[model samples]
Target: MKIYLNDQLVDADEAKVSVFDHGLLYGDGIFEGIRLYNGCVFKLEEHLERLEYSAKAIMLTMPWTRQEISDAVCETCRANGLKDGYIRLVITRGVGSLGLSIKNCDKPQLIIIADTIQLYPKEFYENGLPIITVPTRRCNPAALPPTVKSLNYLNNILAKIEAQHLGYQEAIMLNDQGYVAECTGDNVFIIHKGVLITPSASAGALKGITRDTALEIADELGIPWREANVTRYDIWVADELFLTGTAAEIVPIVEVDARKIGDGKPGQITARFLEAFRRRVCVEGTML
Candidate 1:
């Protein structure tokens, strides 16, 4: 296996980072999980745009130009002989002092890994997945905006642990105000009365890449859609429910909080979106 560390590719066993790196000590870093399909990096430009947005939001400077980063990502994919896989692009504040100050940090480190990932089982995709709502609330937007996409995922991790302890694979996290924010690692979407709804960014949703793709597909298919605040009741009675992310792609949710959604089966609209998404990925974005 090969890993892209710093500005070059190295053997996975040889890739390493300093123990004092602020990203390790204080979770001071940002990352993007990208997907590659049919020898093409799906939505690669959009992912890089989001990466830039995250860096700017956190005041972290990317040491390389956008073109250079894109080249690095493609190079990493080629080095790993990946035609269909996941790519994780990360930028962390370099080695620093023990204290919380960024003043002593040397520079930022770039790491990219391309590999295959299956976020959920195939049966779940075909049969629809059942999930629960966890008590752990999403971080307040004012405290730590979801748009940053930083390394401090302890909040989501705690929610995931809670769900797993009860024997569930995924969980929904509501904002402090009790409205639906998102799941542990994916964006939430529900179809109701012919209109598709997802939480707005202001509602603590991370504005995921796959979520955007789903919305675009929805529009292309002439499915009415909108972004607004969503609640547990909205999901409980949704005609169809699904989650989207770079890693998770599009997954249908059959049940939430023990309530069966629309005969407890994946809806036709959900299937349409998924099919359209699959078609688009193969022909879209940068080729390797």
Candidate 2:
């Protein structure tokens, strides 16, 4: 596979980062997971904007201009012959010393990888995936803001591991205050009383690009959608449950914890959103 490192596209095995790179040593970096469909990048500007937002959050400056980065992504996609695939763009505090000072690190790494990704099995999407609410609460935004898409994903990974051990495909993490924050890698939502509701950013949820797009789609379809702090009580009594992310897209949650959601099947509104979401991606955004 071809990887975009700096301004060049090279074999993945050959692309390298400095050992002292803070992104590797101290997780001092930000990233974005983007999608390309039919040779066109989905919400390319929004993803870049978020990447910049994350970089700024950490006081790191991107070495490449946004246009340069966008071009590199397209070039990587073309080189890899990707019709539909995932893009992982990363920027890190480059080559800093072991003592955690950013002074010596005069460079930042810009790496982009374009490839296919399927976070869950096809059957899971077909049958609706089950989610377990793990005990591993989300990292408090006060401790480390969830808005910054940093490399430190151990918290989310641990929850996912718990889900795997429990024989479920995905897991949800609650915030410190016992509100439903998000899944291991996706923001979650539920339909209640004909309204689509999701945890707000203050709830410790990642402000997911796909999550916002789903909200827009909901509005377009005349399905009421709103952002608010969501608790377990909301999840248990909701008419429908679903999760959204760049990679996960839109997936129905048939069961949360031990309770069945909407007759233990994908609810009508969940199905509707999924259908609308699936159709919107190919039609929306910048096409290559």
Candidate 3:
């Protein structure tokens, strides 16, 4: 395997970063998880745009332009001979002293890795997954916005731990105001009476790329979709439930908190969206 470190590609075992890097020391960094499909990158521009937006939100200056980042991603894929895989693009605060001040860092570091990823087992997707809600509320937007895909994921990790201990595959977290936020690593969606609904960005959910793609698919299929502030009760009584992310793509949730969703099976609309999503990614993406 090869990793893209700055402008050069190096063997995975040889790739390294400074131990004093603020990204590892203080979790001061942003990242994006992208998918490569059949020698093409799925929604590459959207992911790069989000990455830039996240960096700007944190006032972290990226050393490369979006076009350069895109070229590096494709270069990394070629270096590793990766035709179908996952891409992790990271920009860190670089090496810094033991301090919280951003000025302590010299320059931001860039790391891009192309590798295969399967976030869930085949059975999970085939039979659908059952999940539970956790007590770990999402971080308040004023404190640390959920929209930024930063390296500090302890908040979501804590909720994920609770779910794992309870023998569940995933966990759902609510915002400080008790509105549904999202899952540990995916965006939540529920269908009701032929309508697809998901939490808006203002509701503390990360603006997911796959989530937006799913909405586009819904529109193409003539399925009504909307964004709103949803509650636990809405999920409990939902006609169908699903999750979307760069890695997860679209996965049906058969049950939530012991309540079966839509006959304890993946609903017709969920299946339709999943199928359409798969078809779209195959042809509608940037070739490597």
lDDT of each: 0.94, 0.89, 0.93
Question: Which has the better lDDT: candidate 1, or candidate 3?
Answer: 1
Predicted candidate 3: what Cα RMSD to the true structure? 0.8
* Model 2 misplaced regions, further than 4 Å: none
Error of 3 at 139 (Å): 0.7
Order by TM-score, highest first? 1, 3, 2
Candidate 2 residue 159 Cα shift, in angstroms, is 1.3
Over 10-59, each residue of candidate 1 has an lDDT whose tens digit, in order, gives: 99999999999999999999999999998999989999999999999988
Determine which window of 10 residues in candidate 2 has minimal summed lDDT.
279-288
lDDT of 2 by residue, 144-195 (tens): 9998899889999999999899998898899999999999999998999899
TM-score of the candidate numbered 1?
A: 0.99
Q: Could you give the candidate ranking by lDDT, starting with the highest?
A: 1, 3, 2
RMSD of every candidate to native, in Å, equals 0.7, 1.0, 0.8
Candidates in order, TM-scores: namely 0.99, 0.97, 0.98
> How many residue pairs collide in each prediction?
0, 0, 0
Question: What's the true lDDT of residue 209 in model 3?
Answer: 96
